[model samples]
Target: MTAQRSGAGANDGSTHRPRVAVFRPDDDRLRDAVALLDSLGVKPVADSMLAVEPTGALPRDDAAFVVFTSKTGAELVAEEWTAGEETVCAIGEPTAAALREHGISVDVVPETFSSTGLVDALGDSVDGSRVEIARSDHGSDVLPEGLWDAGAYVHETVLYRLVRPDDAGESVRLAAEGDLDAALFTSSLTVEHFLAIADERGQREAAIEGLRAAVVGTIGEPTRETATDHGIDVDVVPHTADFEALTEAVLDRLEGE
Candidate 1:
């Protein structure tokens, strides 16, 4: 179903609908993002920057608390594993929902949906517990390190590897030409991959300049920091680190501008 147009704002001064860049994997997520943007009356440039390569491994079976950092991880684990007696922990509601889809009961979901937030949420309770973290190979060291520092015996399983797709730079081309209106970056890796593709195309400087002219929104502080570190001015970061929140904030910012 199409979402209604956000009435008469960013498009007022332009002939065509604003073209926003989206960098989700070419799957249901990408389809949903494009649909959402279309519903908002914006043209979506769907450039999938990431591709998943599963490791064919499962989370360790002995931990007292098993942690899932993403919906992808939760779904992967559920394929061949069960919760058993362990307390299942998800980094956010999406992951929790994925776990539940597999009939796994989630015991914890942090108030904040980040590694640091999960560490804080587990708190003193993990002081003497065994925590198993299952996620991508490129996952941040923050979760494991924090749990280790908090006195939990932490084990990490790389369920997959996030690789940049070879042909994922259409958005970079659009940004370099100043034809794009906005970008929604969901993670630091997406920001990094976008820039890497720009550099490869020898349009890195031009793309950054074009992005500066358009609205750029990141899903969280870390993603915002990544964009800023690469000289792209980030216009918005939603309070919740999710795609829906990032999309709404960005559209709102575009309307206000």
Candidate 2:
């Protein structure tokens, strides 16, 4: 089926129908965002960029505090710990809600839903605490480093690996042909994997040239720095790194353009 547009005024004759392409894999966030786009009367084209794979075994010890930055991380931890002695700290409300659904009450919910937000909310609790971070294998070291800096004994268990999707080559090819108006990248891995796919399809430059790219409304300095290094002109980044904010950023950028 053809993708649907969302939100009125997206194509109200004054402006052209804006098309925003999402590079997230099949997940709840992507589905919800697409629904929102449809409500906004904007067409959304999806190309799976990252595939989450369960990586290693969970830690045996009952963690003092379990930290999760992404919903995927929370889900993995929930699967491992049917009932545990850990107090969960989530970076965002949605992830906290996800944990709550699994009978886990989050002890700390960050105000901003970013890694820095987690650190800020954690405060003294992180110091001298035994914290376990559940995340993908290729995630950033910021969380662990921040915990360590706070005097916490932090251990990271790889719950999953973010790998490039199998159909990424075809997606890159399509983007290179200007089939997409803008491509949304939510993570550094998304940026890396998308470029890798483009390279494999021998359309790296074309893909980059054909479409504008936007990062998840909020990202770390390192992620932004990496994007700049790769010559990607980031069109939008939300003040907070949440799906809703990211969607708004997309809409605003589309309107501006």
Candidate 3:
């Protein structure tokens, strides 16, 4: 469905309908994004950029508590690991909501919803605590490092790994062809992979600067640094991880004010 709001799109003062390229995992993550885009009357080109690969490791049933950094991580843990007496700590509301849907009550949902946010929210409770952190193999070291420093006994399980999907390059090509008015990055990994694909297509600078950027939380913060290096000004950031907020960020950019 093509969603075009009147007087929204392009900075040239033309009434062009804005099209946005979305690079997210192809689960509810992508679905929810599309739903929000539809509600906002903005067209979205849904593109799957990352796929989750299971590592065949489950969270230890005997752990004191468990930490989930992403919705995918929570989903994987909920699927393979039975709920014990462990308190679940979900890094973000989306991840926490995913766990709650499975009859799980999350003990903590951080304000920032990042690794550092998780550590900070857990506070001294993490001290002398045995926490099992489930995330991708290539995830940031902030959680483990913070837990260790806080005197927590950290047991980490690589529940999944993120692999670049084959269609990502095509999505980058579509963006480079001026088919996209904006690009929304929900994760830093997406930013890295998108830039890599653009670099491979030999228009990394143009792709980085030519389109408007809307980021979610700190996920898109790192991308802004990269975009700034290419002289691209980031247009908006939801600062919250919610898809609805992200949709608004896109709408704000589409209006070109």
Candidate 4:
């Protein structure tokens, strides 16, 4: 999600700059969110719950079409200097934008921005195609399974592994602090990791209950459910799953408060 313009506001003549806890694994997207928050005069507690570490080697020119479940996976292709030109399918708009920055035209982006939506979107094209489903270490299974059912020659690439930061102590502490006005969760894993880190630091309950009124912007419905399961009350879920929308939603929510 690239940065988009929005207006700034403060409640009741208070100089309280609303702070947000942001957790997205990709660098570009995190930057975009940070920039948006900065533009709105909101202080962002920017820290990724998960860090992307490259793991498996990328197969050279092996795919006619590839599915990227995360922006980090799509960026790895550019970082490793892998040859472009393969038809790419990104799980969401941000991943597509990242690929487009490298001049790779995205063939498809799921209307629903989920694995099932991508599977349905690729229906006939996947058949007889050399497809690669590339993602982080704890990669998902539904996309590859659906492609195989479509009769595609599929290769799974674990380009990187997403691990919780070793020094999440500060992040967890800040998240639970009363001054934190909002929290942004880009994925279900982010919610899980945020809570896990808080729990690890013995602040899970306060972090969850304390932020009860904070505008929790979950990127999608599934992530909303995960946030709900963690007892995080979600205040907004954008129609499109991108940081551009998330930033807008957070701003709108803050304005309405």
Q: What is the number of backbone collisions in each predicted candidate, taken in the order shown?
A: 0, 12, 0, 0
Put down candidate 1 lDDT per residue, 2-97, tens digits, no spaces: 222663453465436878899998888999999889778888999998898999999999999999999988887786898889988999899999
Worst 10 residues of 3 by lDDT: 212-221
What tens-digit string does per-residue lDDT give for candidate 4 at 1-257?
A: 11222323433333567777788664766787777787777777887787888875674477888788887777777655444677778898878888788877788898988887898988888789899888877755667888899889999878888888776545567657765778888878888888888877789987887678577898877789888987889999998777778878877788777
Off by over 4 Å in 1: 1-4, 7-15
For TM-score, the strongest prediction is: 1
- Give the clash total for candidate 2: 12
Worst 10 residues of 2 by lDDT: 1-10
lDDT of predicted model 3? 0.72
TM-scores, all models, native as reference: 0.94, 0.85, 0.83, 0.81
Worst lDDT 10-window in candidate 4: 1-10
Q: Which ten residues in a row have the lowest lDDT in candidate 1?
A: 1-10
Superposed Cα deviation of residue 239, candidate 1 (Å): 0.5
lDDT winner = 1
lDDT by residue for model 3 over 42-148, one digit each (tens)? 66778777888988888877778798888888877675566778888888887898888887888888889677888888888878879898888877777899999
Q: If ranked by lDDT, best first, what sequence of candidates would result? A: 1, 4, 3, 2
Model 2: per-residue lDDT, tens digit, 83-182? 3677778888878887888888888887877777777778887688899887778768778888888888988878788887776654566568866666
TM-score, predicted candidate 4 vs. hidden true structure: 0.81
Give residue 102's error in model 1 in angstroms.
1.1
**TM-score of model number 3:** 0.83
